[model samples]
Target chain A: MAFVLELNGLTKHYGNIQALRQVSLEIPQGTVYGILGPNGSGKTTMLGLIMNILQPTGGSIRLFGEAPRADHRQKIGTLLETPNFYHYMNAVQNLQIAAAIKGVTNPDIDGVLEKVNLLQRKNSAFQTYSLGMKQRLAIASCLLGDPQVMVFDEPTNGLDPVGIAEIRDLIRRLAADGKTIIMASHLLDEVEKVCSHVAILKKGVLIAAGHVDEILAQDDLVEVSAANTPQLPELLKALPHCKQITAGDAGKWLLHFEQGTADLRSVNEYSFQQGIVLDHLLLKRRSLESKFIELTN
Target chain B: MNLNIPHLLRIEWMKVKNYKAFWILMILFVVSMIGINYIYWYVKQQFVASGDIAAQAAGSMIFGDFRFPAVFKTVSQMSSWLLYFPGFIVIFHTTNEFTFRTHRQNIIDGLMRKQFVVAKLAGAFLLALVCTLLILLTSLVFGLISGDGYFSLEGLQYIGFFFVQSCVYILFAFTLALLVRRAALAVGIFFIYGLIFDYLLAVWISRGTETTLGYYLMPLQVADELNPPLAELKKVIGSTNQWIALGISIAWLAFYCFFPIRKFEREDL
Candidate 1:
């Protein structure tokens, strides 16, 4: 896969504390890569380093096959932290300045402002903006010059639920438009919903890194809930596809499948053949939060 | 390399234009400088027409007190005022970078740190020049209207001195703000240094047995000696003290520009 950004043995330190520890990551082109970690996990530091806002103590970064080119700066639109803009300038003026700096002419600042649902507030000073509006404005600034790479650090750091949903949809839309997005956030649920791949950092170390679906694809277990819990456990135990059946809380039975022991076909067949009724039958999918907890520890 | 200096200049210009405080302060400086010149002119016209020796001496006193030199030989009079508002304006121009965190965005937007610094310096230099010229022209026009006949070659020389002095003062102010990095602290120091420190220290030193001690403490002594607005100061104090003042101003400028740029280059955004 073509990588839009690549870090080679990237490490950084603040005083005696290490912020990043040889944590190299490749953000593939046209992929939304979520960087997941707790606070002080080098997430913001990594974004800072990428934008050349913070220099790495040791290591190097390449953006779109170049080493810190002005052209690369034009390619990447970064919201490295809570958006810091001239509070007196309105949204249009703010984006216009950004566009001018990037050498983009006649930029559709208004269009991007509209995309972020900030068109109506385009003339409002940033100081007068609500937190959500500020966030939208920041995102709008990033969309200037039609940059292919987007990097946001805690983009939803202080957004309401509706604001969060708006940002989530915006990120999804950006990805759908084939924009490569590299975002660092502590919001696992948000990342899980939008990110195709992720890297989880804990205390300056990358604890986990892979595709979201593949990372959560662990042991497959089926959850079966019924009124007659005892009879359900017994019924699951006798099934050929069931490797091991265990009883769970609230009249639930967990049937573990060893090496593709249970398929949807056999699951349906066995349930129909046994004449057993199940109140609920759902696939036991691994949640991102659980996976995150497992990795961070 | 054609590195798009014009574009960077445009960006800086837009910032200057949008900054309401900058425009308001500049306008205030222009209007006040002109208004004071007009007041001096009116007073001068009354004395010259009345043919009263006492009143003429009073006119001289007015010139002495206000220090609005009837004829410009160099920028000494203008330099004194330059030290006041234009320096503060220059400081504000650069200090806004730190206060607003716009410098970080400027970097992220693809302007090299070197280019950004150059743009700021250039912007400050141009603004100082324009503001000083405005004062010089307004004063010359007012002086001419009052029949002072001060708009001569000597007057042009004084205006030139004013321009150079303003630039130097801006450099001094720019460096201070850059080194300090806080709006209130930088601006406060600028005012105290320009308006208060020189006056208090000059008086305190001049009161002593050595009358020449004021030369060291007075801002004009340093400014006049370095810029040499009039040829008279060198005849009076010799070039040695002038060289010393110039050296001090240069050192201050170095500390202001280099120290802050170095610190900012290493600082995390």
Candidate 2:
């Protein structure tokens, strides 16, 4: 597919309760796509449906441009919801089962364990693992076979701050290596920092999608200040593509503009050409948390 | 059924090979199985010695419990009672998957729903075979040692019946674990339903009749009639026709084998 994954009106319900509604989106190849939502917003359910863990009540899914199949999942790495392993099996043994299922003739089990920093404790049973270690082991299992597409549901759910950052970097490095990743998380900041493309789900509805900047651009804000420049407000308002110019705290003017129109250089050059450049110019992009709350609300 | 069972079973073996509880239970089962038979044999020897001496003067003997054909029947009857021991293995393994949510992971790992369920049933089938093999070996030892008429194969068919019954019991336990999705509850229900409830109900329903609805009850009760404790009990429990007993066992077999495949495919993990 032009996209690595596609969902067309995917819907699921548990008897009278709807867990996921019609969610249709495409995850393009080579992009780290995020399914961003809050708890019970259907992120995990959506991921489960895609991986065939849960059957959809209504909809169609296309994996790599074909109808979804079990082997299609083999070509992709997926960790749904939690780190599920045999409590009695060690790390090497658990990954061996996953590798066998994925048809990987030889998986670098030790390499992945080392990558997740679980090599020292590789022989420990999963039940002995702390939550972060268990989560790391799950990620290590996903890295088996070096799949081109990887899907993770809350990859850093139980991680401490350092572990979370490490996982985020691993996701970034994997994406940089040209792999397509689909990660579902309730952590909006995680998605904002990591995802190139995003789909926001709120209460089972797909509320927003497309490029992250485009989604975050709905409330793009720019702060402009000059050395006691009396004409800054008038100049900002008169500038092209400026949505609004309003006064802000500590003697600043907040200029609102559409996505690309919020280019800080243009504000500087425009003010300079108008002989208004003097002190400060700043781009105030909205955090995903606010965007999420706004869109979800 | 699609011939991927070997690979699936290999994957299954990987899970249990390092599982200490599985091997512990298995060793305990085999040892207990053989040990229980030895006890029964010793008790039979004592009973035969004490009771037959007086009865022999009256022109009858009571020393045939371990005779060539009777030994086969006796061992199978004993083995059938311990089917639940291996059945707990099935319950633990099955419910452990649900408990750990690895059931979902297995599906996520690229096994078709059919492949996963079939592999599980295959595991059950193998476990039954293992139990049957143990029974067969024990029967041989007891029969030969008893000097039971030069090792006749006359009643060897009971061992085959034992395998069938074991498959039903283990798979029924697996079905309970899959449906119940919890260990204690599955074990509890299995004991209550398979042992007490099914037995008393089937017995009441059959009422020592030669043929009746109770003879076909599922899990253990259906097979209880097939396992001949008293030669006369066989006639009262199952129909005089062997085909009917075979048919009921096969029906239970087919249900346990294929129904779970369908359910796993349709149900959300």
Report interface Cα RMSD per prediction.
1.6, 0.7
Give the winner by lDDT: 2
Candidate 1 residue spans exceeding 4 A from truth: A218-285, B1-3, B42-70, B73-79, B148-151, B198-221, B224-259
Residue pairs in collision within model 2:
none
lDDT of 1 by residue, A168-226 (tens): 99999899999998889898887888899999899998877889766544456788776
TM-score of every model? 0.82, 0.89
Residue B19 displacement in candidate 2 (angstroms): 1.5
lDDT of 2 by residue, A130-190 (tens): 9999999999999999999999999998999999999999999999999999999888788
Query: Which residue pairs overlap in candidate 1's backbone?
Result: B74-B158, B175-B256
RMSD of each: 5.0, 4.0
Which of the numbered candidates is closest to the native, going by highest DockQ?
2
